[model samples]
Target chain A: GAGVSQSPSNKVTEKGKDVELRCDPISGHTALYWYRQSLGQGLEFLIYFQGNSAPDKSGLPSDRFSAERTGGSVSTLTIQRTQQEDSAVYLCASSLDSLPADTQYFGPGTRLTVL
Target chain B: AQSVSQHNHHVILSEAASLELGCNYSYGGTVNLFWYVQYPGQHLQLLLKYFSGDPLVKGIKGFEAEFIKSKFSFNLRKPSVQWSDTAEYFCAVKQALSQGNLIFGKGTKLSVKP
Candidate 1:
């Protein structure tokens, strides 16, 4: 079975520029999540989507961060006016269902660097 | 606010040595516990998870974790570690039966010497 996959494993961009990261969840997965990992820090919850609808997006740091899923399969995380602090690894995960206990399969992640 | 804590930032051991990593959560209600491992240049992978049932749960690659509700802890352990076991380990928790977003602790890096 194909695992969750992310595109542009690494991205380097200038400050104030906008960037988009893509994630493809496994087939039949109904739950998708986005998280960010800063250098030497823990993974920070960003947003979540259940079958193309996001019910909880409180973890988003600010209005600059936004994510959306389409057809319950692919998701895109967008950061507007990137700042130096926004440089981090963006991770995506998906589960068979939206249950809290369902194991999440993670993607390789997109490392974004803001210069 | 709910949060997960990993006490050890890094651990170094020789091959075949016993390994233990401590994790604690601050949530007061029922929660799901998980341990994830990321080897060098690899995506994060599930090592084990605890939702309900026995406190002691075994996972892939001979790993096991003990979930102690009283102490609000879920600690990962391995009888023996090989060089291949070197990786970054993360502890995560989420409120049971609620939204599926996870709160993760700062990962602990394990370095093994063969």
Candidate 2:
């Protein structure tokens, strides 16, 4: 079985630019999550999607951070007007369902650097 | 707010030495505990998890964690650690039966000398 996977293993962009990071969850997974890992903030949850609908977006640091999932399979996180503080590793995870006990499978992550 | 705390920022030990990493959470209700490991250049992987049942939960690669509700703690332990066991360990907690996200602690890096 293929685990969750993210695209653009590494991205370097200029400040104020927009960057899109993609994630592909495993087949049959109904719960998808996006998180950010940085030196200053550690690991922080950004959003969660259950079957293409986001029910939790509380972790988004600012309005510029947004994510969407389609068909319950693929998700894209877009950061508008990226800032230097946005330089971090973006991680994606998926689970069978939204149950608290269900284990989340993580992806390799996309390392984004805003210059 | 719910939060998790890892007592140690880093741990260094010789091969065959015992290993213990302490973790505590701030939530007061029922919770799900998890220990995740990330080896060099690898994605985060589950080391162990405790949802319910026995307090002692064993996971892959000879790893185990003890969930103590009274102390609000879930500590990871390994009797004998190998050089290959060097990695970063993370403790996470989720409020049981809630749709909330998991709260993670600052990871503890372990360095092992063979």
Candidate 3:
């Protein structure tokens, strides 16, 4: 499809382990975003990458959550020492730009479970 | 602080019933509004958006939303809903001062009976 694509539709891991989630954004999209959707909670912005520049990591819940967008295209979200509380659907979205009017396209998302 | 509120957490209605979902924002400035729908196991899709020009905008699936600046409200409505409309709907706002990113509400789950 021409939409965003995420790897590992579902992920399960033991507590305190680490996991990596990948996202391939729409071709030529310069803006990439990472968000987490917890049960009963809205989507929480984690980080954003704009054309390979330094990303905005303001929304990361903790230092353990890190993400990187290589060549301003595919991105990866790595969670270190994952805890049970970190279990949620990690969603990746891409947009042409983060401007006030640009609409983002979201991927199906990767449901991560920390056992 | 800028926040979006969705008063209706969950709504249930039979097919063909009219639908309305209330959404309000706290920002007192020009803002862009949007409604996104997520099916059972699908990604979030844009149902409609209001950037400028029209206060009442029409979207796919016979859905429409009116933007009211006075009350800082943007509610989603549909003349008739179907079982396929059973999904989670999210309301979000992009305030002029929001740095161009969206702040989404908790979302409302709609269940339509056929």
Q: Per-candidate DockQ versus the true complex?
A: 0.90, 0.72, 0.67
Please tell me what DockQ candidate 2 reaches: 0.72
Scored by lDDT, the top model is 1
Q: How do the residues A1-96 of candidate 1 rate in per-residue lDDT, one tens digit apiece?
A: 999999999999999999999999999999999999999999999999999899999989999999988877899999999999999999999999
- Candidate 3 chain B: 10-residue stretch with minimal lDDT: B94-103
TM-score of chain B, candidates 1 onward in order: 0.99, 0.98, 0.96
When sorted by DockQ, best at the front, the candidate numbers are 1, 2, 3
Candidate 3 residue-wise lDDT at A81 = 99
| lDDT of every predicted structure (CA atoms) | 0.96, 0.94, 0.91
What is the TM-score of model 3 when looking only at chain B? 0.96
- lDDT digits (tens) for residues B27-81 of candidate 2: 9999999999999999999999999999999999999999999999999999999
In terms of TM-score, how similar is model 3 to the real structure?
Answer: 0.96
Which stretches of candidate 2 lie above 4 Å from their native place?
none
lDDT of 3 by residue, B2-100 (tens): 899999899999999999999999999899999999999889999999999989999989999999999999999999999999999999998754443
Recovery fraction of native interface contacts for candidate 1: 0.94
**What are the per-model numbers of colliding residue pairs?**
0, 0, 0
Q: What is candidate 3's local distance difference test score?
A: 0.91
